[model samples]
Target: MRKRLFILGLLLIGIFLFIWINNKWIVVSEYTINSSDMPAAFDGVRIVHLSDLQRTSFGKKQLPVLEKVAAAEPDAIFITGDLVDADRFKLEPVLTLLNGLSEISDVYFVTGNQEISKDRAEEVLSALKRTEITILENEKAKWNREGETVYIAGIHDPLMDISTYDPLIDVNFRNQEIEYSKRARDYTRESLEEVPFTDDFTFLLTHRPEMIEEYAETPADLVFAGHAHGGQIRIPGIGGLFAPGQGFFPELTEGVHEFGDIRLVITRGLGNSSFPLRINNRPEVTVVTLEHEEVTGLNK
Candidate 1:
């Protein structure tokens, strides 16, 4: 009986670990947000979103994966932070892969925590500037799609204040906490950034996903964020169990969540951190289709 019990225990452990290594990706999460005020031509506007490259050498194989996203024929490509890891130094390969993507769609970018690492941020920025990419730091830019212009606002990685370069002495964000609230608001209010929010449909590209509640009340129609890496673990029904910010039993782990007037879409992110391992949650680059959520549909 004891031996049988032992075998059952082993089997359970095996299944438990299998859950950790489950594969949940199905060619990115496609969301269609319906908006009444959105332009008709921009009605089915498609966007491909990528985050947390960490400046790693993804090679030719990874390059093709990106083409898969482009193959979706997205109108725009949006990248949210963590482009490079810094200390190790070398974004050339990542840049090479991105450079080829120019043929895919209009590309826009925002910095991430890893990109701001003092070890190579300045250097990385210099190289990035040389590219045709738009580096949005507390700024905004507009793209004309079929006569109507759409605005995308991007903010620098607020988490870059600490971590990276110096080696992250405190993994615990204490008094050195990053302020995402005020800075995000300041960028919007001043119009010193991307598309102004009065009557147009706007999207905010951010690195950290923890501030959904904070940005929920802002003028943004859709906010895209990635940093949690889908808690790096997920259960069948419980969903992503770990994520940055919001603490312990964190509310936002990954995927989409609605907060009042704003809709927040958080990517599980591509790449691993803190741990060099990943199971079920594979790296992801999303192709999200924004369907105008009729102004009336919002209350639901």
Candidate 2:
């Protein structure tokens, strides 16, 4: 009887391991963000946010990830950054996915910390340009439909070049033990100065979710970010366990986080950077639908 029990335990362990491995594979998460600020014409617009790819590939030529994006039938796809891992720095998977996505729809790309951290930054940038992906490097792009415009802007990660940051870190934020919030906010404001807040729906694509406060300070109606990688591991009732910028028990690891009038959508991200294992945290591709409401409250 004891021998049989031991075999049964091993089988259970094997099954558990298989399920864990499967969860690391790509999973599409859908979200709808309703805002009073959204334009009537832009309502129901679908956006697929992909982040922290970090040299991870799904199936042949990233077909699993691509197939999911294609299935969404997005109006636009926003890639928040970290397309390649800083250490590994693989090109084929990155280029393959980018080329595939560009053909499907309008693809907007942004820089994550890894993009600059990697030695092959210029090479990656050049490939993106060649693919005809709109690379928003501290610049804004306009998408107009039916004479209505949606403004999209992206900022280079502050860590890419620290010399550019404002010397004065907001002590108030630091005192609260919030790392990089002040500096990130300052960097975001300076980077986005030219793109003014207008009546149109404004979207900011940032790689770091830690700068949510700074992003909210701006006139952007919506912000999409990825970098935390779902805190690598999540603890059921406690949410994500840890993240780079937000640190232990990160408050803004994944899902929707609000900052007054503005909303931030953080993707769990597909791929591992530094951490090899994930527990209860699956690779994700988030789809957010723009909802225009006549009377808006903080309900959704």
Candidate 3:
């Protein structure tokens, strides 16, 4: 009996250690995006994609995250929102991270559902405006290199449409949830309509990855997004068990998914929101390298 109890205690300790490591350890996911539409001058440009911070601090002043991003030597950094959690609203951590990131490379941002769910979005935006970071809200920005240009566009999260934002709307009745998603999609379409997309390589930054269809309708060649925290937990072969917008067995939890001519890159994100624990899904910072594929007559 004594030996059995000792073994059980050891097993429990192992379980605890595993959970702690998964939550605290940060992983860097790398991907190479190749496209003939890419400008030759922009070839080999690196982009560090971060999302759904939810006010998580990795080391003092976000050193862990900053160090990882700096190591990537990114030409630009894109954040897809949830920088502050409405439940535990704090702007200092988010600012600290932004300051460090700014020193490394140009930073770009977009709103997430969490930003809209809380009334403090204005505060967040105000703080960001004080920095060099470009806040893209239903707008477009131009990225140039060697006189060649590409467009970067961003849209506000659909939750902004709600006069009284309720984070729990997803957990409500099935019909209501469906209606909310439909409305959100329409809002996304409307927002994109405001941004003009040229034939040049274009990148779209948004919070939710589940809105792939809305984004696909646009002329964006690439989309960087988050909001599904790797579905909170991952099963080896089964993938994410659940996600906020996608629900059980959510499809767009992480990785690059293609929709016709466009590709969507979903970062697992760095922090937790409603769910406090992450199982098997380690927090990650995504590094995407752009490669301008040379088109040949045979391929064409």
Task: Please report the candidate that would top TM-score against the real structure.
Answer: 3
Per-residue C-alpha lDDT of model 1 across residues 43-146, encoded as one tens digit per residue: 77888888766633444645645666767888888888776665555677667756866667778888876776665567777888888788877666877777
Candidates arranged by lDDT, highest first: 3, 2, 1
Which candidate should be chosen as best, given lDDT against the real structure?
Answer: 3
Between candidates 1 and 3, name the one with more favorable TM-score: 3
Candidate 2 regions with alpha-carbon error over 4 angstroms: 1-23, 163-186, 194-197, 295-300
Indicate whether candidate 1 or candidate 3 has the larger lDDT.
Answer: 3
TM-score of each: 0.78, 0.86, 0.94
Ten contiguous residues with the weakest lDDT in model 3? 162-171
User: Where does the lowest 10-residue lDDT sum fall in candidate 2?
Assistant: 162-171
Model 3 root mean square deviation, Cα atoms = 2.0
Estimate, for each residue in 150-248, the C-alpha lDDT of model 3 and write its tens digit: 999999998888637454655667777777788888888999998888887899999989989889989899999999999889999999988988999
Q: Is candidate 1 or candidate 2 better by TM-score?
A: 2
Q: What is the C-alpha RMSD of each candidate to the true structure, in Å?
A: 5.4, 4.9, 2.0
Q: Candidate 2, residue 227: CA error in Å?
A: 0.3
